[model samples]
Target: MTLRRGACLLMGFALLGGCNLSLPLQGRAPQEVSHRTSSFEPLAEAPQSEILSNLIQRRSVIAEDSALGDVARVALSSGARPSEAKLRTAKLRAEAENKNWLPTIGPVVSLTSLGDVLASLVVDQVLFDHGRKKAEREFAWADVEVAAVTLSQDMNDRVFTALSLYVTALRGQEKAQVGDRAMRQMRAFNRIVAGRVTGGVSNLGDLRMVEDKTQSILSMRDTAKDEATAALAELEAMTGTRFDGQPVAALAGLHDDGGAPLEVLKADAEAKRSVAQATIQRASLLPGLNASGTVSNSGSSATLEASGETGIGLGTGGKLKAIEASKETARRQVAEAQEDAARKQSRLEQRIASQQRQQAEAQRLAQQGQETYRLFQAQFRAGQRSVLEVVNVYEQSVRRALEGVDAKYDVILAQLELARDMGLLADGDAI
Candidate 1:
């Protein structure tokens, strides 16, 4: 009967205690992602300003129905993306931390001096924690933001890789086509040299040299075909979709001028996380007040307690100052990250511009070489140029054509890299 009365009394106190606390015991539930982004004052303006808008507008670069988009969809859906899973976990943890200020209930057991068992139900509520709970909540929120940035980076990387491989396969195919045309022209030259030798106008050595040159062109074409086949196989394995014909559309000019790059966002999130953690640690060094109610079989009791280190030594001040310094360090890291991102963006922009120029120059040179080869062919027929000189001019023209093909693909590859860095390869919602 006494134990039953004590249990009832404990239940009554638990309810009363829950009602008396100053802090919010029942915290708010998890909100939408936009709310999460806007709630943090430091990073609040960054997302809403223009980066997110630009991300939405950039979706046209890789439309949902395009081949690049198909590969992205397949790779993202292949399995649970690790960064996205981490983001989910961080949100769950934040949800759990939200209610950390609430009172806790647990069973407590002990032995009496006479070796008897003493058990009770204890309810513990932190009455004063020096803002430890608040700092912990902030830490959890920052973690979610960090995870969010990481997820975006991962998705962009995956899409960039898939798209770059597709471009590579196409590049190899185009080069092989150029090689095939060169081989056909070389075979024609070989036929002429053979007829000249049979008519006693050209020696056997000339015929052999033309035949060898024809063989070399065939080998180059075969090598290029082998490269295309390998790249296509790899792309198929990665995306689980085999491509029959890849598009050669330009991927440049897709990057917008305004946007916070992923690196800056990641750095800011991590800085907030670091500072919050340091606050939590500093709070741990100070005393905390807790209120508790206990109910035993015999009776019920209530107590208020202060828990922490009993003494502060000489080094304690230095430790506290060091923690403050660590916070400053975190802030400085964010600044450094912003600068680095700006430099890299500038460098990529410059590289893209330079490659575009190189592509144009290569195209011009290739055309000029073709015209030169035609004049050399005319001279050979007029007996002004040797068979070897005509053949050499043809090879030079083919070489220029191959260089032009490389420059074209190189520009596309660099553009894709820039897009990946800017987090423009995938949509924000998709991440």
Candidate 2:
């Protein structure tokens, strides 16, 4: 009898030692990525607006999207920001969930109906559960992945927004300067028309027309100035810095786009989400085995209760139908993500091409404007055209030049966006 008891003890020990154990959330997660510094160098003849843009990018804390991602992580860890704190809590909850899969162990004391007291070392383990625990763990891991990628996407969006704002603001400043030049030309025309009226060479109606034109140009100048002001204010709010009106150079020399095609990226993103959910659903459909062992001693008697419960249930159509449905939903979402990614890739490429065409068109217009100014000059030398006509053509030329500048920037912006979509913003100037 003693040998039999010793054998039972040895078998229980072996079972306990042989059970497979898994912990899902035992290590630290990866941190946010950092962006490279800007490589903008202002030339002596650079526009003031462009120079301010460079300054803002170099000095502002919110300039780099990755830097903001880091701030978000730090805030989440510190529980300082409300949104970040919630993410932190969710991450902690995911890590804590892994603890549920571990075996339960403790000391037990029981009193029987016959007034006998017993003491035992108790252990309960899930010997086999059809990979339910693993599936759940993988699901939890998916949540972490979703959160991480969500943060990255958000930061990328922020970078694009900042870039758009800065470019628009700089463009507004340049266009406002063009308006100023138009106003000056109108002022000179007004003077010349006044002199002609005094000399009886021009009628009051013609003088009135020129004065009205001057007034319109002045209004346009004011409107342009207001637009520039508003754009600068928006940029200031975004970067938390003052943006004084300074000349800035046109955007040029974009970095190389180094990233996978949009199709691959989208598929990868969807897979991460779907696989986790599928794991959870599949795990829930399998049978589970729960086992427990107790070795109790009371006075001259020893008792052993070795028991287990195994459960098998219908899964896809019965016990786990809800889980299966959820898995299907995840699949659908992956399909949608793929479609959206393809659409985005096509649209971005078209925009890059369109911007190039616009740049070419603007150059042609600038040339046409110069030709018009030259023709007016020739007409003036023949005493057939007024100086105002030549000056108006010159204004148009400057306007086209401004448009060309903006068009070039648009091309650069499109390229940057293409890089962003390819996940290559990590290498170049992102914001």
Please name the candidate that would achieve the greatest lDDT relative to the true structure. 1
Error of 1 at 131 (Å): 1.9
TM-score of each: 0.85, 0.68
Q: Could you list the CA RMSD of all candidates, in the order they appear?
A: 4.9, 10.6
Cα RMSD, model 1:
4.9
Pull out the clashing pairs in model 2: 47-247, 47-248, 48-246, 48-247, 48-248, 49-246, 49-247, 49-248, 50-248
Off by over 4 Å in 2: 1-94, 97-101, 106-122, 243-271, 294-332, 387-395, 426-431
Per-candidate clash tally:
0, 9
- Report the C-alpha displacement of residue 150, candidate 2, in angstroms: 0.8
User: Each candidate: what lDDT?
Assistant: 0.77, 0.56
Q: On residues 1-431, what C-alpha lDDT tens digit does candidate 1 reach at each position? A: 76776567556555644553344435657645663231112232122323334333434256677666676677656635777678778877877876676678898899999999999888787767777887897898788778777777887888788778788888889999999899889988988888889999899998888888788888888888888888889878887878864566666377464677889878888998899999988888888888787877657788989996544668878878998999999999999999999999899889989989999999999999999999998998898999889998999899899999999989888888888888888666555
The best candidate in terms of TM-score: 1
Candidate 1 similarity to native, TM-score:
0.85
